[model samples]
Target: MFNLAAKPFDYLIVGAGFAGAVLAERLAAGSGKRVLLVDRRPHIGGNAYDYYNDAGILVHRYGPHIFHTNAERIWKYLSRFTTWRPYEHRVLANINSKLLPIPINLTTINTLYKLNLSSEGMQVFLAQRAEEPETIRTAKDVVLAAVGRDLYEKFFEGYTRKQWGVDPSKLDKSVTARIPTRTNTDDRYFGDTYQAMPKCGYTRLFENMLDHPNIKVMVNTDYREIVKSFRHDRLIYTGPVDEFFDYRFGRLPYRSLSFRHVTLDRPQFQPTAVVNYPSTDVPYTRITEYKYLTGQTHDQTSISYETPCDEGDPYYPVPNPENAVLYKKYETLAAKTPGVWFAGRLATYRYYNMDQVVAQSLALYSQLSELDGSLAQDERTKQSIVA
Candidate 1:
């Protein structure tokens, strides 16, 4: 167990990601409380950390995390951290060595089917080929409904199987439903109102978020070891909820990631920053080139290849009915745990992007602060005693 150097804090926040950062900022700035933010990683920004690579290009440490959200509050909140760059994410799929626009757009259809069909014609063609699901239950239902049997089988099935270690037919519909299909030729991946990356980089943004003097950061520290000793009146547990209970019920299933980052002595690799290899034959799911997102020009560039492995850092929760059932059990166990509020992707066991996690953390912080009157009363008592 890693030992602490100093005294405990007023608020002990686990995981200095979006959840802990938001809560720490709120309690430290708003409540005037001392908050200690801890993370197991060596850095602050959870999966959204970005910094200048060896080639001096701003590179996303993890896979590409494009900030896109329809939530006005989320957009406004992150706007404080860094300036926004106008970037709409476009992705390509490498199928049989031929690059095609993802989401099965009109252009993709025309290229794939070898027919110069217009938008309307493409729509009609897809309707003819699309398979109507019996009940529309799984990821298979979602893909078949959006595209068709042929497109679904070609693009999604193999990818889904390799990515999640499960057949699309057995997974939740929302898993594949995330990939949108368009009648028009809009090649943008997300159809959100706001989509952009930080002009300075995500690491700087996180640094700004947790720069408050009242907040203390302890990186490479697990919450399990020193949580009990923290002199905090309230605790925010943002790590795995099941682990907190010592897996009294059972270990919650988590889908992990093994990223293979390669630095090439080339200006560019692919046309876009992201290229999805939706084939089982390929060991990796997607390859993200850093320069495309940052618009940085250099002789060499760094790219991260996302390989969905069964081990390494847990990135996603396998969305299935059985997992949901287990999550509910964990939730119940979490709720019963005193002085601990579970938040963030890992704690909640939900797959959240950077923007979603920020928005969620912001909202959750407000709710927790407003949950009880003791916090307010304690502050008042401190002020009165000071007087």
Candidate 2:
């Protein structure tokens, strides 16, 4: 048996993603504890990894991750690592051989329904166009209520069906309920107080954050193999809760994505950062031009087309009744497991943005520290009795 006493680490954190890195930083910096962060993948930034392509253009290797949040604390915390670059994410949808703004705005509805009406007229038209449902409960219900059956089937259904690998009709109300219909012509994707990307890039920002002397990172190392040997007072796990339990109850359902990153020998490919393809025939959800987000005026640019696939790394949790039930079982098991604390997207099984992850990790760190102090005091009392 590997001796746990041989290793010299205070905290063992799983998955060097946002949650692990942030927690490690807090424990090491705030509490002055030695920390070891491990990731199964041989990378630091996790899914938000960015690198320069052959064209010398900074590109999102996984997919586009635009940092936008309303949380002031999160913005202030992230500002310590890297300088912010102003980035407003705009989305275009290719429909009926024309590229148009999304969110089914006045222009979108007018072009889609072929109505030459003013903003007020568009609002009135949409009132008539909107489907009157008794109660909106499912994804279909929520979308159908905003834009009528015609627009719902045309814009949301096919795209969502391909993206989640489930019929929109079967999805929960919250799955697609956030999408809003606009009478005015506001084409911006998100409405957040802090909407910007790192000027240098996300990887560098993460690198700077995790580069502290008190923090130790082990990439391409599974926690299971090392946890038996490594000596740590506490654990901060950011990996899947199901994985932590070895999926004893059952695997919580998660949606995975496949990305096809390509390089184009031009300054730009599309006009905007992203173009949503809301059709099953397209085979891809959206195409993101990296130059738009990076603001790099290179001779050539890079783009990534997202194709929803079954087999890849788990990205998003499928928020359905069956998965919810399974997750509840995992939650119960996670609570029972002593010395292991869970946080982050996969562990919590929630759809979280970057800033949200950082904020959640910070909160988790505070709780973990308090728990550690209490446990240390209890252990010291027990040792005094023996002495």
TM-score of each candidate?
Answer: 0.93, 0.93
Clashes of each: 0, 0
Candidate 2 CA-lDDT value: 0.85
Give the per-residue lDDT of model 2 (tens digit) for 1-387: 323345578889898878888888788888988888889888888888899877678988889999999999888888888999998888888886788888778888777767888889977776787886798778988887777788888789899999899998788888887767777888888878889999999889889888777888889898888887777877888877787788898888778888898887777788899999988888999999988998888888788889988777888888778888889998887888887788999999887888889999999887877887998899999999999
> Given candidate 1, what's the lDDT at residue 205?
82
List pairs with backbone clashes in candidate 1.
none
Which runs in model 2 stand beyond 4 Å of their true positions? 1-7, 373-387
Cα lDDT of model 1 by residue, 143-195, tens digit: 88877888987899888998899899878888887788887899999999999
RMSD of 2: 2.9
Per-model C-alpha lDDT, please? 0.83, 0.85
